[model samples]
Target: MGIAELRAESKTASESTAALLRELVAHLGENRTQLREEWIRRITEGRLLTAMSKDEIFAEATSVYDSYVEALETRTLEALQAYAQNLSERIIPRGVETHEVVGIVLLLRDVLARSLFSKYHADSRLLNAVLDAYEPAANAIAITVAVGFVRERERIIRQQQEAIRELSTPVLQVRERLLILPIIGLIDPLRARQLTEQLLRGVRANRAKLVVIDITGVAAMDATVANHLVLTVEAARLLGARVIVTGLSPEIAQTLVNIGVDLGKMNTVGDLQGGIEEAERLLGYKVVPIAEPMPA
Candidate 1:
């Protein structure tokens, strides 16, 4: 064929593909409820979406279905990505797994393709063109959704890790120039590093001269933990903050002694109250209870 004829044929094919996609989008919009119900049914029967209630499933399916139709109409992945990010934010905290999210997207593709094939089986050429256009668009949308979901999930995980780090090693200022860090759980090397960072930051922030590390809630201590504690005390001293180690259980004390980890230069207290008292004494303050006013 001549170049002009070939160009014309290509333009016609392009127009045809665009028209078919619009038709598919229209069909999806018109039959949304039916398609969503089928999608939900398939997802419910599958392994991934068993925990979700029907209402939850239907709501999410409706959102995804409508977004997918919009994406097809616009021939862009933006709608799908926005919908996926919103869905991920809602569902990840609800305990929906990543694979489950991807599974639901695949299920939508399956249902739509099946419905399309059933309606257009008589016209092979048109059916082929529609499928060719639809499959890639659907797959691309699914991939975009999955990517968005995964990125959001990763962000949530990072946030959770930061929160846990803060919770695991909280430094509190109980009085002027006095700070207390109550270590309630097992301290590993990583946590020890986090604790040291928090302690130093807290000391600087509070202008603390004394830091009381109360370990009353600690369950156990090993050589590594002992080493971490010793390092923390030494670091605090370097920062000009005197460290008081308190609430050392008999077991932990023996463990520390057996490991030959010496904390002799650091102040020692029997309990949290003792630590507080010592901190106050070092700061030259005493908590004197005020007498209550006589009843009227």
Candidate 2:
């Protein structure tokens, strides 16, 4: 064939494909409820969407079907992407997994393709063209949905980690010129580093003259943890804050000595109450009991 004839044939094929896409979209729109029902049945029967109610399943299925049809008709992927983002946000909080989200998209694609093939069985050229457009669009939709789910999950994980760090190391200003850091749980290297940073910040912020580190909640200690504690104390001392170690259980105390850690240069107290008293005494204050009132 001549170049012009080949160009003419390609144009005709392109136009024919567009027309078939429009027709397919129209058919899907007309049978929207039926399509959604079939999609939902397949998903529910497969136990893929187990946590969602019937209403929720139907609603999600309808939205997905509508978005797919819109994208196929308009020849744009933005509609599907927007729909995926919205769907991901809605379903993520409902405990839907990423795999389930992608599975639903793939299932809908299969159902729609089956419907199209059944309707246009005799038109081989049109069927081929439709498949060419539909398969890529389906894959794109699945990818976009998966991306949205993963992004949201990662954001949630980061938020949770931040919360955990805050809870693990809490600094409190118990009184004027006095701060307390009540350590709880295991103090890994990362948490120890975080604790050091927090202690320094708190000391500067409160202009604290004394810091009492109470480790009553700590179940055990290791050599590395003991070193972290020593480093934190040293850092606080450099900032001109006197640090008093408190809540040293016999086991932990033995651990410190067995590891050849000499806390003798630092002030040590038996408990939080003793630490508070020592802090008050260093600040030149003394607590005294009041006398009882005489009976009238």
Candidate 3:
């Protein structure tokens, strides 16, 4: 396809993909509600049926529940398969537009039995039956045509995150004056340790008086994570660099308090802007309204 045609096609595919996802979400939600209600009803009925008979009532109730679960599983499998087939046909009418076809196929592959089972594990037999049908449905949903789409998405996300992390971890701006470091993803011990090393090296190498450690992208930090942060601050102090912690989420602050992490010695700020202001103050500089002329 020509560039304009390709762009148009891409836009169309993107819109369709979003629409399909919404439809799939709605379908799954409806099915999930149905499954939960059925399971609840069956379990409630089974509990009431118990006559305190140690053997007969228990066995009968178990069997009845199992039968009901199996029937439900069969219905779910048929419905999902029908849905997948319908979506596939709609996206790829005559000759498959390779990109759009792949996207639709991947939608089926990414939704797996393990996830569904996690949601509906009240009945093992039903879960197994769903898996049995899900496998065939996924295979038949023309996944072969777009098998790499999911992988491509995963790869793109990974690359973008890595780039953001790199951006967050700042390099030296000026000698013994400024430094930046970014913490990306979850703040775990391993990542924290790595970040600590990066900060220490960057600070020492650049002779940074102020080091900014940004954690805006971090999901959460456990006690171990908190310890790593403390260690990094201590290490930076030893290197004669003031550590400026940025991106202090209220939830993270609460987590630190709950974990008994007293960030007393290290300076904490709301964001990079606050950190910059604090850094300027610490350096005995002020943001004046007018730029002062240099005395020759």
**TM-score per candidate, in order?**
0.78, 0.80, 0.39
lDDT of 3 by residue, 1-296 (tens): 22243235335554544343344344454565454444334434434323234353334334323332332333223333334344334333333344544432343244334456675589887556555544443443334334333344455567777676556555646424788676667665655665777778887777788888777777677777877787778788888888888997777777778777666776789888788777766665424535442111
- Mind giving the per-residue lDDT tens digits that candidate 1 earns over 1-296? 22233234335657778888889888888888888888888998886766678887877788888888887787766556777898888888888888898899999999999889887899999889889778877878788888888999999999998799889878998888899999988777788888889999999988988999999899688888887788888888888888999999999888888888766665789999998987776666324345332211
Give, for candidate 1, the lowest lDDT window spanning 10 residues.
Answer: 287-296
Q: Residue 171's C-alpha lDDT in candidate 3? A: 63
If both were scored by TM-score, which would come out higher, candidate 1 or candidate 2? 2
Per-residue alpha-carbon lDDT of candidate 2 for residues 1-296, written as tens digits (9 for 90 to 100): 22233234335556666676677779889988888889889999778878899988888888888887876677666666677777777877888887788788888888988988887789988788778756655566666667767887788878889789988878999898899999998878888888899999999999988999999999788889887888788889889888999998887888888887766656789999999998887776323335332211
What's the lDDT for all of these models?
A: 0.82, 0.80, 0.55
Evaluate model 3: give its lDDT.
0.55
Q: Number of clashes in every candidate structure?
A: 0, 0, 6
For this target, which candidate reaches the highest TM-score against the unseen true structure?
2
